[model samples]
Target: MTKSAAPSTEYPGLFSPHQEPLPGALDGELLYSWCARFHRLSGNSKASTTSQMLFGHATTGLRHDFPGQLGYFGAATGGHLGTLQEIVQARTQFALHALFLDESTRRATESVFQGNDRSQLSRTLGLSRSGQVSLTPLKACPACIGEDRGTVLTGWWRMDHQWPSMYACLKHRCLLNVMANQGRAHWLQEWYLPVELREDQWAEHTEMGQSQVERLIHIARWTEALLHQRDIYFDATLLRHVYLYQAKARGWMTWDGALRFATLRAAFADSHRGLEALPGWEFIKEVGSVNGGFLGLLLRKHPGRRHPLKHVLLMAFLYEEPLDFYAQYENSKLILETEGPAALDRRLTDMQSRLIEMVESEGKSANASCLELGIPTTQGLRLLTRKNVAVHRRPRILTDALKAELEALLRAGTERDEIARRLKLRKAYVKDYLATQPELRNAWEQAAKVQLAARYRAHFLRVLEDNPDVPIKRIRRIGGNGFEWLYRNDREWLAENLPGIWRRPET
Candidate 1:
């Protein structure tokens, strides 16, 4: 039967997310070619669209003015087009035009301002602080249309001079004294200047409050400075003082534990200087180490407790170390504790008992116990098979029609090959079947044994007959005494067993 189709979800995105695969679009060669092109283009330094070199005029030592430069600006009028030609003449003419226009516009704006009637000008034209008349461009230049076709130009007039004030404000001096002192006080002052704040309000605070805040800030600053020092003066001194105090109270802390806790505390505190610090194990160690102390008394009562406690301490160290180290240490500790001198003999005895139980319960031989301990299964099976008591049971061949046919064939004097072909059986099988019959099998065996003995006996007799003068003792010796032993044991029995072979000497 044909297999059922796989569920659609099993082939994710194959049919849905990307319809069926496009015949030629998914070609790997095409993708590789595109990738090559992209890499080449991206790495090319001389590509025109992204050239790194600057462009300038040699004579004037100024940036080169191209046709495209001012083409993006939309303010140039019909008269301004003529002014753009004649590079040197255009510059002078443009400056003159700007000066004349500025003076005229200034006079007009000043007359309006002195009139003190702001509503007339406000209705006709909005006046800015520096009173320059605003006019919208009737049409954009070709370059401006191409570059900014989709963009709004409402703030284009202010774009030229807008960045100057931002640059100036960057240099403005901050009035930080008005705020209360904070550690990194300059950072707070920088934050406050841009937002408008009254100086007088800051001066109204009591001098004592500011002094106290400054002193606290100074302390915080000093603490930070002490922490950053590599020589370890103040922090180490503080840790030593704390260490001595804990030691004096309980008199049990180890130097190593104290040093470890001090180091951990210093590193942790440095990262979180403004936060609360973690408690160390100095007190615990002190109590544990003191004579007649809580932990000390426990240890005194149980001398063996120190090893397990030390193992636990070592585990804590491993927990702080890498995972591989932790696993190695834990595994080693478990094996050590389980197989130590105190427990080795008992453990081995228990293992032997367990192995025996496993074999007995499973009805398997001792070899199966080796298999349970991860021995090769095939090797274990072979070992167990050798020990199997049932192996002595002889194979039983049942009498059937096939056996009767073979007997009939043997009675008819049929050749083994002819009998095998008639019964559609192998020659070996026919031979084996005939051999199972007691009378036929015994006759065949005796005949084969007699023939073998006769050949050797005939050779011996021929040697003796050829040399009649030879002594009987020497002749017998030459024939071998072992041959005589064989004749005495089986010669008469073989003659009686193979009467037909005796009658037909050739057979």
Candidate 2:
């Protein structure tokens, strides 16, 4: 049978403010190995060295020296080595001391050095005479290390102070300065040091009494690690204020006090994984005073401790904090949850109604109307009215009176040529119109042939009726077939009946 571990004991108050201890430091070899591992994980070239891995450089002549020591090179002041790593290590060491030691020991150790000349002791370590000394252990930072080692460095430095301080170094100084200036360092000294320190038996600089320095270093390292972790998840510049506020609040407040209540509430957001399960403002009220402001109002009215105001307020602040990402995420979620199928259905229904209306307005026979509506006639028919709509317009035909006139002339034995001359219309027009009519279609079709034969007989009779001055042969020669045909059919008859007179040529 497998054995299960016992549940851990809980603190009496879930909402009580607690000082969480920093994680333990890895061994020196492990740290070096981790640096190498970090380089490998980052996909850097295998030719890189540990210093290059840590400092972002690959120089062959880089130097290493003890913390807070300075070196000189050809009239130039240089010292310090592994500035970033050392500062980070110092912070970790301070945080660890704070975690393991009691407040009195921490305080007593902090009080040992009154002035800020941390580098005064560097002379004993064989550093350059022209180089300045930094009194504060935190000032024994990475740049200080690099300066002592005669190597170039990168990152933050105070221009007026003439010392390059890494971000980690500055943070440590800031935290301590906030405590010291605010008169709260004693609070930490009182709460975190061991009980034996209460008797004043502890000697300064002894390993037993190094807890305070250890705490400072541990806090620095832990803070650095926390910063690194946060950088992985968020933009560092944006969250810098948050970390600063937390540090200030923690240092200034009485043990487990209301200092960070608002900040804590703001940090707990639903979007932050696993935070929904944690008691936020209720936890704050349990440990802090009820008269503190909006949080206090919540605690007073909602004593049930289940009101969602805390969570709501937290989410609101977080959404406000990172305006870009939060707003985009919120908008995307709303569009996804509310718009998909319903919006599509509404659009489709509108299209169908428009199609129906268009077809009904333009009838099926009107192809131009279908073109105007951007739909093919076949598809448009589907949308038209179900009833078979009829069109009344048809092709025009010749009238009955016109057809009868042509038929009477055709039956009269009067020559077709004479009839055409009397009508004064084109022969083809009369023939075509007569042929198109069903009643006279056949008669008109054969009329042209019969008309030519009648013209020949008429021409011979007309020539006998009217004798001309010219011989028949010359007249036939001058007129040829066309004039002879006209003369025989109608011209000769007109000349014989009428008085002799010259006529103009037909145009």
Candidate 3:
């Protein structure tokens, strides 16, 4: 039988949010691209609407400006985009943090996904405040796009092609395209379909000769492998040791066990000969310089993270296979990373920085931040306060009855301090509230007179109702506060409403 047509309402996205299948995801499609697709489908005129709908607040810079805001994305959407299966795929299958970040950096960034409360989600790779990097260009594979069009699909950006130091596409064995006019952050401001192959543009970004082109392609494929091939995280220190040990064995390091900067730089230059046609090639060359220009940056004593491209390109030159690189790292005889008081000190310092960021930058509750960091409240709170990070607890809402009770206490001439203490509220807040409430002000002004009348009115009524024999003067005496004040303020009220026996004045 022929398949029946689905209902008109059976359409996806007819009722709620929808996401286009993440583009080029199997080969590392970026989360940022998926965010743009989601925004487009949302039909939101303002990009903030999409961000605010996903994240609790409307933060623009971190949303589209970077390739991944994994923690923030996971928190806001909770892995729900199209469906449960899609959520799993996008978060697990296509995630770059799991592959790119060093162990500590990955732990810090992925805290949000794991439901841990680290404030480092907004941070870019443990960079200091002064170390803000410029936004890199959004890159695309022109050949991939041209191929996609053959299947009637639009070209889209791929993560593997866009990474720093990746000069070509591993899949198509071709150099990637750069949209110079359209930078990374606002690329999603307008719809951007995948590009078709442009020979002129390709020539601009790539080298001409087959030999020069073939060499860069190897580096690109190696970078892609770095993103996907690793099943377990390797210690960056061990990796560094392995690289140095291999470099020494290959005679690429000095007799003093230092990186042979000139030789390595020469090799890098020789491999990608004439690639200066691509923008920023000079800077990469300078970083790879043998004069210790960026050598200390790549291999550090304490293990500072390097750009993924720097690690991959160096690995590409040093070893034929990624496994060979891993094998070298595994057999290294370097001191253990987790050892001694120095290690303890480093761990403590890292925790402090993470806590301060969580409370100060991420606006997490200080207590929750502490709990997530697995530290004690006393120590965490003390450290945060010492660093001048405000440990703000969530404000409790004032119930209507609390306001009424406060009004009552105020009317009864209770001290503001006593009222605050009794209600467990701030004195300033209570005072400010009373100043704003006209009803409370009115009650306060008439409280003395109201209390006087209330005292006399009850006694006066009981005498008339239950004891006709009781004297009116005695009833007035039993009422508290001054009888003269009541008489002067409420004489008419008393005279008109009292029983016949209590109606007349004693005089």
Runs in model 3 deviating more than 4 A are: 1-15, 18-28, 44-48, 55-78, 81-104, 112-124, 129-132, 150-152, 183-188, 195-208, 254-260, 276-282, 287-290, 300-303, 333-507
* Model 2 weakest 10-residue run by lDDT: 70-79
TM-score of 1: 0.14
Model 3's lDDT to the true fold?
0.54
Model 2 alpha-carbon drift over 4 Å, by segment: 1-81, 84-230, 233-287, 291-507
Q: Please provide, for model 3 over 131-250, each residue's C-alpha lDDT reduced to its tens digit, 9 standing for 90 to 100.
A: 324444567776777776766354556665665566677556676677554445544354343553344323344436887666677666555455544455655565666666666656
For model 2, what is the alpha-carbon lDDT of residue 456? 53
State TM-scores per candidate.
Answer: 0.14, 0.15, 0.50
Q: Which residue ranges in model 1 land beyond 4 Å of their true spot?
A: 1-431, 479-482, 490-507
Candidate 2 overall lDDT versus native: 0.31
Displacement of the residue 425 alpha carbon in candidate 2, Å: 96
Q: What is the clash count for each candidate, in the order shown?
A: 2, 55, 3
**What's model 2's lDDT at 432?**
61
Give lDDT per model, in order: 0.30, 0.31, 0.54
